[model samples]
Target: MSTGPNRIMDEFAKLMTDAAGAAQGVRKEMETAFHSQAERWLNSMDLVKREEFEAVREMAIKARDENDALLRRIEALEAKLAEKGA
Candidate 1:
């Protein structure tokens, strides 16, 4: 009689363990599916990637800086020309 109860308890523990493992597997699959769906949705929105945006931003900054430098050079040349004319 004692052995019978012990055997039943052992079987129940195994079943619980298997159930826990199956639950974890399901959780992982759900996470993977969610991630894939999110990525697809984002891609469909025609969004620029971070790296590409950064590159374009840097180019704009460079062009602005170059324009400022050219403007300064032109002002200095105008000043020189006025001195020459006078």
Candidate 2:
């Protein structure tokens, strides 16, 4: 009777250890799946990530500034033309 109880306890302990390992593996798989799905969604939307968006936004801002400067020069030239016409 004593040996029988010891063997049962040993088996239970092994089963518990195996279950724990399986659960950890399942957790890792879930994490990987979620990561893959999110990446797909982001890509499908044609959305730029934060870093890329910031770089493009900076370029746009520079272009807008340059355009404004050009507009001012054009207005100045137009004024000179009007003066010559007068």
TM-score of 1: 0.75
Model 2 C-alpha lDDT per residue in residues 1-86, reported as the tens digit of each score: 44788989988999999999999999999999999999999899998889998999999999999999999999999999999999
Q: Rate the local accuracy (lDDT) of all candidates.
A: 0.97, 0.96
Candidate 2 TM-score versus the reference = 0.62
Q: Model 2, residue 19: displacement in angstroms?
A: 5.5
Model 2: residues >4 Å from true position, as ranges? 1-22
Deviation of model 1 at 7, angstroms? 3.2
Identify the candidate with maximal TM-score: 1
TM-score of each: 0.75, 0.62
Q: Pull out the clashing pairs in model 1.
A: none
What range of 10 consecutive residues in model 2 has the weakest lDDT sum? 1-10
- Residue 61 CA error for candidate 2 (Å)? 1.2
